[model samples]
Target: MTSFILFAALLIVAVIAILLPPLLRAPKPSTGADHREANLAIFRDQLAELERERENGSLALADFEQAQNELQRRLLDEVQPAASAPSETRPGRKTALALLVVLPLAAAGGYALLGNQQALDPLQRQARITPQQIEGMVAGLVEKLKENPDDSKGWLMLARSYKVLERFPQAAEAYGRAGALVDQNPELLADYAEVLSRSQGGDLQGKPTELVERALKIDPNEPQALLLAGAAASDRQQFALAADYWARLLAQIEPGSEEAKALAAAVERARAIAAQGAAAAPAGQTAVANGSAVSGEVTLSGEVAGQASPDDVLFVFARPDEGPRMPLAATRARVGDLPLRFRFDDSMALAGGKKLSDFKTVSIEARVAKAGKAQSSSGDLFGTLSGVKPGSQGLRLLIDQVQP
Candidate 1:
């Protein structure tokens, strides 16, 4: 700010220096002075003519004297008024002084009224809004929405705001109120699906999956929709479909970016799972595919069993002991079916080309979800048995730990 002010002061000084001198200097004499000088020169010429006329005997001495006297009288009359006239340059000097005072003040006043004074303040430029302020703004928006319930655009904006705040339920409600506005917009549909899934404890089944499908139909290349669709497919154990969706998403992303690298890794995993499943398809005809089926009993321990509701989902799955975490075989039930007998084989493989027979050893897990979701979350009961052979039988898997 100091530097800016110094530069502005210097510029003002330079402008004043350029303009003031011309205004302050004394002005040239007026046309009356020129007229007086012209008249004297004329008088001198006439006097010389009169002298020549008398010397040549063309005029008498008396005539020559009279003519010279007349010329001298005229010259005196012209010179007297001009000599008595007051100087006109004083007023110009006064105007220059007035301008010297007014110009800088006018410039400063105009800038104060119109310029951005806070631009030079780094703190003001970098200031961030507090969370309380954001909440207040959202509250105001909510009040406005209540008064104008038919405002679809407002509802969409409110939905996005709620999503940013991680208030999933409110975001879902706002998206629903957005009516037809969100229905045709692929991005909004994807966002709505995401928030709806989040609101339901991250289960993308049923409506959330349907919303994602709708977004994909509208714009097959929509990135978020493809991502969500891939996740939904992966959750359903359709690894081939998941791979396809992610590959499509990958095509739209810039290569060599972090996001692209992560996505590429996911696509490869899904494709590998799909390839394994495909390889196992022919072996599905056998009862155990060379004794690859693993038989087990899943039981919830008494300590965490009481914490699970009857309708909560139960997932039993096996992953390779040393490779990617994608499940090779899986089965689902409910908490009410605890202490149930379970079997996983090539037939139960979730992906087209992956099977339990492929792994020499695997890790089996059982999770009782409180929210009926496949993915474990806080308060879910789960247990893991590692280094178990695929063809192992009569294994007892206990749900002993509570996810935090």
Candidate 2:
């Protein structure tokens, strides 16, 4: 709107500049100078003719003198000044005023008819795809797919496009078709798992975990597969396994890159949690107890250590690999008791059927519970280690990041 007003004002100023000179100019006065000059020249010419006639004996001297006087009188009549007259500028002023109103209106009307006002709107000027354009593109792809249903690359492209457009169900379907045609290519499998996970509210376990495992089987070092597997492990409270997967992925990427750094940090955190689980074994049970005991040391990170209270509860425990997420072996201690050593075995099981020895693998988590709750909650500082075999020892867990 501001830009529109500025352009209109500029147009008005330009019109005024073009028309002002004629409107404001003074009327020229007539002083008879041109008439006087014309009369003098005529008089001189007649006098010369009369003299020539006299010399040629074509006229009498008195007649020539009379003609000369007549010419002189006419010249004198022309040269005499006339009375002054008033100059009326009212008509010109009225015309100027009318034009001042009409020109601007005309220019504005013309611009309204020919110009695109939206062009001046910076937000509108940026090109963006509309819903209709997206629909058209999708229709085109559908038609192409109908004609070439077995084209793996086409299906892959369509799947990616659907993912970008946030049509997760369609993307998953397309990815499935592509994967089938391509014999479950590792990259496609990974992408399929990702979109499927997104469709399921980001739960990467169950089917998504299976897909990730399949991708890993095809190419164990595949970055996406490793990343997905690590995320799944972390979500399942298996920080140790997550660390292993991310560490493998980290080795494949360029060092010092943001992804590599993030993976390295995650690896360190997972290792810290694993160490804490190892320390969770009982005081006198440093040696293996039923082959499922986990022993480790738990401590807070530097950032959290200073602000943490000595009375804060630290919960360290192990959970079954595939059964319920409830802790299988657990213990609690105060923050002041850390860098406190911990030990956990089947004797600490919350339920008899959920013991660590019952599972082939287990996960360990250590949380600093400011709220003093046994169950993890928001704002609790925690770390985890996953996929530990029974009787792991000498692990270290650092309670660094907070639960969101």
Candidate 3:
């Protein structure tokens, strides 16, 4: 708008320069002294000619005199001052005013027709299609990936785009393909795990855990693994374990970082739970007995922890530090060294059985041979064998139910 106004002003000034001089000049004013001089010179020449003519007996004195007087009158008329005329106020001011108004008006018209209309129409139209355009763009990306399947980066991008579009199956396929291209990449594995976990409704894919382990091995302090581990441990009711993972993550980040603050706050919450437990020990014991066994079938179900890597089993012994360190007696069923199930009953109290009922509190510790281990989980335990009666439907934590 400002530019238009400026242009209009300049145009008006240019037009005024072209028109003003002619409009203001006196158009038909009479000639004065210079004209008179020229006229007198002509008259004198004529008189001289007449004198020569008389000397040569070509004209009579009376005729010569009449001609002379006529010429003299013409010369005098030429020499006389021009007729007096009132000079109306110069037209320059009016011309300037006209240009000032007209140019701005023209400029405004041009601005409305050219700038506003032409510039804004396209912008508004483009804005209207923005959402669809984004979706279409992602679709195009996936299509391109189909044509060039070998491009790892392209596959990764397409997978992420598919996830954004909520095409879970396609996203999983794309992520899988990308993983194949870039094997052992912790970040890629982590990203894959996130997608798989979401697509499977919180069920960690076989590959994600493997990736998590690999990532931890690659970078012991990887925040994502720590966070995932913390959440997983928390889900298993390992409050202290969760705190450990979260605290480790927070320590790695800058103290003032937002992530650091958030993780720190989470750790604090875990600590509060621990404190609450400590405070309500007697009251909690009356209700939550540690020595009892569950009566009903717990339907133990979970993937075998060491099926893929038996040497890296992370068995958690959930028991209080002050109590008999040997856990309450329990029977573990192993299918060829793969933890298949755990049986808790009266017969589980022997020296050979895993003592499951003695501890007032429980947590887990796993030996991970990988370079890095996952941090404590923030997720709550599905159930704990911590407080079971001697003959109650105690917890039968299915290995298959373990969700990380």
Candidate 4:
């Protein structure tokens, strides 16, 4: 409708231009001195000629009449004035001035009615930075934080950057400081756990695990919490737990996305680990496999952390300190402040093909940290295989001063 109005207005202006010129008639011309002089000059010349002819006795009545008529015709021709000079260049040039005023106003009014101001806005036209560019920016922020640690926001950005870099420990430390600065945010806590796990030498057995659990408690459905929980569970051989965590995380992950694909792979890994444990059961030995609990007899023959003497505390508690306390899974003859060979002699209670009895698996961390928390939070299994496994020989692990 507005377009039609504008078009009609322009058409009206055009019709005015086409129709107005003829209606606005020019003023009538008045006789001036030049016109009178021109007429009188022709009349005088004819009269003077007639008088001279009469004096010379050559004038006749018919000749006089014809001569007078010729004189009148000459006078009329002489007095025919030129058309009056135009008052202005192209009559009524003021119309053009009116046009000049009207065109801009029309344009402005049209814009007010029809134009999309958002499209014309400079900010709206500005180009957006790509995700890769943003990631790069985060990286630079991290570098700046490394140089100048005082900037809290920069540290947070750096922490996020480290997460992108997969440098978990550094990310955790940065995130921890960020958390301290901003008062225990759930996201920061989650990032802290994630990085701390890798920081403690790729094992979530230490500082990272606790943070993850605490973070989860704060926010149950936190994406980071789910991801980290899955990782921690798998590390501890809690395959079913790992599967559940990852499956929950998959729901949060964008469908058919790279993160979803990665989580899916983790889920499959958990399933495989669970299947291996399930398949380890013997056909007729289900009673023994299902019935026998691990009898942890782990004997630490080494110096316990913060203890006054080797005899201060019994070896049984500290030797298989990390995982589930199975009575048959204890260590023996572990020397003080020395490398101890922890044996897994669960043959008495653990029948063949029973849990962990058949598999030659990885060593459980029986070593104690300075804080007396088990180095491995869950009890570490003896090996990483499924077979009729004997106790690990020449087993050695170093115990450093664990951070508080």
The candidate that wins on lDDT is 1
- Tens digits of per-residue lDDT for model 3, 337-389: 43333333322232222343544434322222122222334321123444443
lDDT values for all models = 0.81, 0.76, 0.55, 0.55
Q: Write the per-residue lDDT of candidate 1 for residues 67-125, one digit (tens) a residue.
A: 88888788778777776666634776887788789988988998899989897677767
| Displacement of the residue 80 alpha carbon in candidate 2, Å | 12
- Looking at model 4, residue 158 earns an lDDT score of 75
Residues 307-366 of candidate 2 have per-residue lDDT tens digits of: 578867677777777865755655555778889787776544432235667788887788
Worst 10 residues of 4 by lDDT: 379-388
lDDT of 3 at 26: 62
- Whole-structure CA lDDT of model 4: 0.55
Q: Which stretches of candidate 4 lie over 4 Å from their true place?
A: 1-158, 161-170, 179-183, 198-202, 254-262, 281-404
TM-score of each: 0.46, 0.42, 0.47, 0.37
Candidate 4: residue 107 Cα off by (Å): 15
Rate residue 278 of model 3 by lDDT: 44
Off by over 4 Å in 2: 1-46, 54-114, 130-133, 179-189, 210-227, 244-272, 280-404
TM-score, predicted candidate 4 vs. hidden true structure: 0.37
How are the candidates ranked when ordered by lDDT, highest leading?
A: 1, 2, 3, 4
